[model samples]
Structures are given as structure tokens and as C-alpha cells.
Target chain A: MILNDLSELAARIPDGAKIAIPPSRSGVAIAATHALIARNARGLHIVAIPTSGMQADMLIGAGAVQVMESAGVTLDEQGQAGRFVAAVKAGAIRLMDSTCPALISGLQAAEKGVPFLPMRGLIGSDLLKNRPDYKVVDNPMADGPDPIVLLPAIQPDIALFHAPLADRRGNVWIGKARELMTMAHAAHTTLVTVEEITEGDLMADPLRAPATIPAMYITAIARARGGAMPLALEGVYEADSAALAAYANAARTAEGFAAWLADAPGIAAA
Target chain B: MEYLPEELLICTITRLLEGTGHIAVGVSSPIPGSAALLTRALSNGKTGVTVLNSANLQTLNDGAGELFDRAAQGRIGAFFLSGGQIDGQANINLVGVGQYPQQDVRWSGSFGSAMLYYLVPRVILFREEHTRRTMVDQVDFISAPGTSPPEVYRPGGPYALVTGLGLFHFDKLRARFRLTSIHPGHSLEEILDNTGFGFDYEGEIPITPTPEPDRLSLLRGPIAAEIADPYPKFAAAIFKS
Candidate 1:
């Protein structure tokens, strides 16, 4: 029932926890991202289920300790290391060579309290054989013939996201209401960042609420004013080119990030 | 099959795209990438066409989301699509059978299947091989189709089928497959090794011209030239971070 500050909440999730963060652009929960960046945490392995090519690039550019990335599209127009390329090649990041399926499948597995979840995507792709990190366990519930794909449970210590609106009880709304719905539902502990955090106004038009990320499922509800929505919808503010530039430079490495942090004292982009 | 269908698929698709009065494409779609590049090369980049790069940033001139809708209002212009699997009636399914549906599959097969297929006069179905598998008797699902009946879309069916080994087309009347061209260095037997269905061969299947390797190099080079900031910029951001 007690809401907290953004930086204060992000710091609660101890370092070295496998964190799941949305990539740049599409509905990426930026309030949570800034929370992480603001904390100046290190050795955190972040999983990014991508949306915008540019935004994802920025996460790597800024400082996503490890990227469990997949899907969307190959954003390689020039094939040169933007920020992601430089990071991966330098061993600053590891290539998952997987997509959205991996991210979602893993989450669902964790939510169900099961060892892994069976998914149908990525059958023929070499991703099955190559990634030693992902184990394909055989499904016991499968029918007579074919082998099913079992994705390992991904119980990231925490899940941070933003909803369009929320009530005091933490009822959430995902504007167009996307798989983000499932993600919010699956995380063991959920934290929501919202544009409007009001119970009176939200409950007034109760039917207008998106999915309610029940108060019990939620840990913290913080309000960060003018949070960046890099790929904000029609009426929303466009992606922050300035903030992205700052992250782009700062996230080069832990050391480079320290200097970038030293410079972040009064830096704020609207 | 490292870049197996690169050159052959590029030339075949672009030649079919010869008629697009105005065209726009996505990032790194080798066929579209090459077609757009070739189309621009043909006119020396003088065409009034608008290009949409990977970043969803429209270059030349055009608004977001309007590109797909614009291509629908056409005659004889071409749209490029290829998949690991193709069934009869051509409804390609890129996304998984059932992944969260919306945000589940990253790049679901053909987003605007009938939406554009119905509007565009010619929809070229392309892939690297003709194996009975890829060129199946009928697709497991229809992601996009060349034609449906009247009170429907363009029943004319697919305009062209470009494969790694050869090319084929749907007969306007029969709506069945017809031999159109054979790629160089590939024999009719090699072609037969690919397709799963049967089609009449007139023995006049022309040898498709192999595009110069110089052309394919543009995938990461000067030609691809940041049509959209989404792709390369996005990719760079991902790996580097």
C-alpha cells in the first residue's frame, strides 16, 4: 500500500539478478529502465524482448549487462557495430540468437511454476541446436507422435513495466493491451510505472481500466514525472534523442558508464 | 544455404517489380533491398518512389503505416515475400501456430496478406528452393495468397514464383503452375528435385540471369544506405549495448 520513489524501488532488486527489460521503442517500460540506470548497478544480466530497432540499440549502448534478445527484425542496415555490435564483439554482451519466443516462452514457464513451457515457434531454425544456454527438455504431456519444444523457466527476480494508467490498488492498463499483458501476469514480482497513478479517477470509469496488475502481484508503485516513452504513440512524446545519446555514450562499459554517471548529476531530458 | 537465393531471387523479384510507379520497402529484405536498389539504379534514383528503411523512418517521401496501404492501390506493381513453407492458395504464416499472437512472434509471416495481396495486381512468391516441401502441394496455412474469387481479391493468382533453381507462374485461366524460367547452371532435373507439385513445362523456360555478386554486396553497403533507421541503427544498438 505504500508507493516509493523510482530510484528507491529499483535499488530494492539486488544486483546480479536476471532482469527482464523491454527493448527500446515499443512500449518499453522506460520508468523502470531509468530506475536501473539511475541506480548505477553493475553485473546485472538483463533480458530484452525487442520492439524498436533503435531503442534496443540504445539499451546496449547505455548498459544492459547481458542481452537475452530475440525477434523483431534484423536491424542491420550497415552491418557496422552501432552500440549492440560493439558490445557483443567486445564480449560485453552475449548473443542469444533467439527471438520473442524465447523471452515469452521462458517467462510463461516460470509463471506456471513449471520447469519449462512447451512452445511451437523456432522449430526448424538452427537456434534449437546451437544455443547451449537454452535447454530443450522433452515434454511428457505431448501427444503420441511429435516432440514438443520446452523452454526453460525464466523467473527473473523482478519484472518492471509501465501501464497507461493505474488505480491505487495497482490495476494496470496497457494502452492497446499487448502481450505486455501476459508479461505483467507472469512475473513473480511486478512493479508498474504509470503516466497517471490515481485510484479515484481510475475507479470512476472502472470499465476503462486495462488489465489490473493486482496489488498482491505488485511490489512497488512509483511515479516518475515525464518518463520517456521513446516510441510513444500518436499523442505521446517521441523517443528522447538526447537521453538516447547520453545512454549511447555512457553504456560503453562499466568504466565508461562511471564517467557517464559522473556527468548525469543534473542531466535530465524532457 | 548461406545467401543461396541472394542474386537469383533479387533479379527475379526486381524485374517483376519493374512496373511499380511508386515503391517503398523495409530493411534488409534482400529481395526488396535488391529490388529497390535495382529500381533506383534503373532510373538512376530519379523515380518519384518513396523508400522506408528499417527504422520505420520513411525516406524519399511517405508516412508510416501508409506504405502498406498505398501499395494496395496499385496495378502491376510487385510486392516481395518468401518463407520456409508455402502451401497451395498461398496464405503464408510467418508467426508461430500460436504464440501470444500479437507480441508473440517478432516478425509474423506476412502482416498484410490479403490486405495487400488483394489490392496489388501482382504478388511475387519467392524462396531459395523448389523442393516439394518449400513448393508444397498446399501450404499448412495461408499467410498471403495471390487470388481468391470475385466479391474477393485478384483471382489472377500469383504473378511470379522465383526460386533458387528456377521460376514459375500461375496461369491466369487455369490458376495452375506453369514453367516460366530456369536459373543458369541448374538443370530441369535439379528444378524437379525442389518442387513437391507437378506443372506443365513447355521446354521454353528461359535461363534466369545471375545478378552480379557486386549487387548482393550492397546488403550491408552503399546501396542499402539507411533507407530506415530502424534496422542497422537498431541492430547496432542491440549488439553494442
Candidate 2:
């Protein structure tokens, strides 16, 4: 569809939906994110995957999500990664000890219409047995196999991506991706926001557009600037320093984060 | 024929440590521990290894990760890691079975092996096995890319791999493994036999340099921080049967 502005698109992300966003500090998806903000919905559980350190904190600060991150990373400008660790510790959000591959496998299994994907890597870790959300299933196929694998399904309702370049038809491209494409491909519904929108078919460019994110899978696209983090590119900018600071403060204070979110710009429940 | 296996491992590590302004190592990694220990104990703690204060890094130090924070702005120089499967170009995937897609892996590592290995230049690859499976025909996955071709890697590919048998370096001139030296009892044929692929080479592998008792103790006690990728569950799963 021809999305002229952010407001027209933000309406699509209804609240109470399981949403997934990219992990890049360069913020391409912010317009769609701004659009989500325009929705002013409540109880929207945002699943923060792939991102490291500061960007995860930005999402949390905006009150766009209750963060679910595997690791914490301090940004180029910070003293340390924001208090996602603290939030998890306080039970404000859930954390998963993830491997990009395993997360992809689980997501793909969920998206491909499978019940779960068997992963041998996470078999006996404290993460599996402790996290009630992750089910440890006995492999029926393991009938007699000694080291049987389990399954992980239940993908997010929406997988949002921020790309360097995308077309009107919603074909997306990210080169040498660090598992971003894997997560997008495995998501149930994929939405991409990019730095630039091209006129020629995404198929025309061989080096950049080796493979296209087919339109059938895409929900919508938006052309927002500062899309890459650390810069105001046709892509997103780097993690919002303001948002990060707010998150850090909230992580330390005795007051619940809701009060902190009251001051930030995120989706407001009407 | 100067240093023994331990000496060679320690000295080669010391050289890499020299490159690192502020060195860091994860837990349970013997080589990383030895390097830090060698630097302080053997090198008289005079080496330029910056002691970052990021708390996670401190867990290995004395219950503080604050040491990791100190290394943030390229302040920390280098680190070490081990790998089960490494390709011709040094990329590590310690996470799992490439053959099977459906197995649950515990604590899929604390991330950053690929991230750090790709981004960090002076990575020391230390694996106990210098054999076929460990030095594979081809890695099941491209966990990270090595010195991306003729282009000089700034903060890049591995400096060395100290296996139980030998020390291997990727000769940037040819972009392949050249046996600089070997442990006391090993030979070029034994080293070559253990390798999954063959590369350009010379007649003999030199003996690896080791550290003295006082030096070794320094590594074990004062200078070196213990390297541990603590996954108590990995032990549980291995022993389950």
C-alpha cells in the first residue's frame, strides 16, 4: 500500500499484540514505531530481540515495550548498558538466555506452522527449567534416541524490521545481516521500516537486493529519516540518548517505571 | 625450540597481551587466564594491559563486572576464546550441532563470540584439539568472518591458535595457516596430519616457549583472572545419562 505518513500506518498495530522489532542502534523502524506511538495503545508487550545495550533501553524508556533481551550492551557514549538487567531482576520484564540461531529456530518453527523446533544447545540450562513460558517437551520422535531435541514455537504476532533500503512493495534488503533476516523470515507477520525507498523494482539491484522480502509477507512500509541509529540517515538514528537516560534513572529509583513512562513519548491509552 | 608448550603458549600469549592495551578474558578460559597471569607474573605486571572496570568483566576479577565498562571505548585491547568448530578462515561456533536443526542448547553462550571475534583484532584461538573435527573441512556455520580477504583487518582475525599440540598463525601475506612452532613432543607431520586442510609450509615446526615456575604461579595466582563460561546446566545435561 502507498503509506503517505506515519499516522495512517500506526493504526494497524492494534494493542495486546506480541510485537517484535529489530536490534539495530541505527533506527530505521522509528517511523513505524512513531506510528505505533500514535496508536496510543496499552498492554502492548514488546519483545526486544537482536538489539544489544542502549537501543533496548530506548524502547523501554519510550514505554513502547516491556523489554525481553538476552544480553545488555553499553553504548559508545555510556557508562554501562541500561538497567534491562535490573528490570529483569525486579521481574518487570522476562529475560531469555538466547543464541541467535536458537531464537531463529524457535521463531521459524512458530512461523512455519510447526508446534516447536528441537534445539540441543539449551537442553539442561537453568533458563529452560526456570522459565515457565518455554516448554521442555519430550520428543516423541526421540522414540529411542539418546540425545533428543525439543521444540520452540509461538512466534510474535508482528516482526518489525529496520532496513537500509526497501521498496514500495515492501521488499527488504540488509547485507551481511547478523541474524536479522532470520528473525524477520521466522516471524508470523513482518513489517519493515527503512532509511530509503527506491523507485525501481528491488529486483533490479543485484548486489544490494540479492533476495527480496516478498510483499506477501510484508504488512506495511514507511519512509522515516534518522532511521539508522548514530546518524540521521534515510535510515534510523542511533539509540536515543534521552530515552536511555530515562530508563537508567527508572532502573535505579524506588518508584515503578510507569511513573517514568508518564513523562516520555510513547503510545498513550486513550 | 625455545619455549615448551606451556612456555610457547605463555609467551605467544604474552606477545598478544602486549598488543592489548587493556586486556579482558571471560571465565573458564585457561589461555586468557594464563595470558593475564603471564603478563603480571612473568612480565612483572609492567605490560600495558588496561584493567577495565565493567562489572561483568570483574566477575572474573573479584565479583565485579564494572571492569567491562572500562573497556567500552576501545579502551580494552584484546581477549581470548576457544572453539570446537573453526573454518579455514577463523570463525567460531561453540553453540551447537550444525548437522541437526532441532536440538535445545543450554545458555547458548553469553553472545558476542561472533560479535567479539569478528570485531576484536587480536583474538587468540586456543582449542585442545588440533584434529579433524575441531579443525573442520568447513565449519557448519559462519559464526563470524575472518580477515575479510586482501583487505587488512584493523580490529580483526585471530593472531594464533594454541592447541594441545601446536601454535598456528594465519600468515597475512598468504592468508593461510603457517606453523610457527609446536609443543615439545610434536612434529610437522603430526601437526599436518591433525589439520583438516593443508597450507603452504616449511620444513620444521619450532618448539613452543613456556614460562618458569615463578611465572606459572603468577598466572595461576595473582596476574591471571579465571575464565569461565559458567553453564552449570551443560554439566547437568552431559551427566544426565
Candidate 2, CAPRI quality class derived from DockQ: incorrect
Runs of candidate 1 exceeding 4 Å displacement: A1-4, A23-25, A50-64, A67-69, A72-81, A133-144, A199-204, A233-235, A240-270, B1-241
Question: How much TM-score does chain B earn in each model?
Answer: 0.72, 0.71
Off by over 4 Å in 2: A25-28, A34-39, A64-79, A133-145, A231-270, B1-109, B112-241
TM-score of chain A of 2: 0.72
Best by TM-score: 1
Q: Report the error of model 1 at residue A158, Å.
A: 1.4
lDDT of 1 at B168: 76
lDDT of 2 by residue, A1-270 (tens): 546666656676667667765444323355465456546644455554533444455454445555354422334233433344344434555444444434545556766788776543333333344345555455565444333235467478777656777776677766534345555656666766666787777766776555466566677776655444332232223345565555556644435454654554442111
Native-referenced DockQ of model 1: 0.06
Q: Name the best candidate (by lDDT).
A: 1
Q: What are the Cα lDDT values of the candidates?
A: 0.53, 0.52
Error of 1 at B121 (Å): 21
